[model samples]
Target: MSKKPNIIVAEDEEYNFALIRIIFEKEGMNILWAKNGEEAIEILNKNETIDLILMDIKMPVMNGLDATRIIKKINNNIPVIALTAYALPEDRAICMDAGCDEFITKPINRADLIKTAYKWLDQ
Candidate 1:
């Protein structure tokens, strides 16, 4: 990509967010960290240039599923990927139902994270 892709990572855990920030920053992507879904929504409303979102399903306030639903309503064109620790089939189904374009189970594989982001941003 010629321009750096701006991405929102909605996660509550500090350690998780830090790890993600380090990895994505290394890829030269512009990363915005949101502690909860509410903050994510706020950021989304303010920034129209965000290319993609990596949403953590389990958050303290407004979980990723609900956030994804609201986000789709605001901007359906932007891809939202569910990044969560839940690996069950039902979890994936729930994320899909909530408008997540993709699902990544934690602990996230570095290659998968980069590959998925590239796929969505490139498309």
Candidate 2:
């Protein structure tokens, strides 16, 4: 059997992370939580097999943009999806410039989240 995809979610809000955890876990993906961008980097450093990252833009310790930049330097192949409350065009552009493979805004929709995840995971 193929191994389940492992995903790291970099989010500072407990409630948001919990919601995402519920959604991804239900889909049989292995979920790892990072409360900030720094923690996300730590997780990446330790776990070499992470398949994707759901990065929150406004994280406290280090913002998603900075983290994404660092992460891209580490592994450009692993897809990083930006999760933000900002839906402005500039926000999207900023995320893309920071090296995010995809962008998803806050108050995440269940179907869209799953579809996006599958798109990146090639499932």
Candidate 3:
């Protein structure tokens, strides 16, 4: 792949994070993994070339909403997609309110993940 897209995945659950990683790995997309929101912030601050972010709403240090807000404040162009288990309407609202570019329901389909990434990566 030429010029692989960079993806930041902020998920605290080890198994869930791994599952997400596996999916991205299969796509041969360059990805950076973060266990929690704070770590996600650190990665962003470190200046990684993240084309997009797949954020989990609930995390240890800082929740995905707060992290997304902060990241967008710093740079709103980076597309952030909420990838969480919370299927509630309010859950999606919170993420969108926090400036998430888009969202996908949890138990993310591998094909959907790739499709979403491709869609936003182009933008």
Each prediction's Cα lDDT score? 0.95, 0.95, 0.86
Which is superior by TM-score, 1 or 2?
A: 1
Tens-place lDDT per residue, model 1, 8-121, is: 999999999999999999999999999999999999999979999999999987999999999999999999999989899998999999999999999978999999999999
Worst 10 residues of 3 by lDDT: 1-10
RMSD of each: 0.6, 1.1, 1.4
- What lDDT score goes with residue 116 in model 1? 97
Counted clashes in each candidate structure: 0, 0, 0
Residue pairs clashing in model 1 are none
Please, what are the lDDT tens digits per residue for candidate 3 over residues 1-123? 368888889998988888888988888787788988888889888866778899998888889998999999888889999987888898788889999988898787878888888899887
List the candidates ranked by lDDT, beginning with the highest. Answer: 2, 1, 3
Runs with alpha carbons beyond 4 Å of true place in candidate 3:
none
Q: Give the top-scoring candidate (TM-score).
A: 1
TM-score of 3: 0.92
Q: What are the models' TM-scores?
A: 0.98, 0.97, 0.92
Error of 1 at 50 (Å): 0.4
Q: Total clashes, candidate 1?
A: 0
Instruction: Tell me the spans in candidate 1 whose CA falls farther than 4 Å from its real position.
Output: none
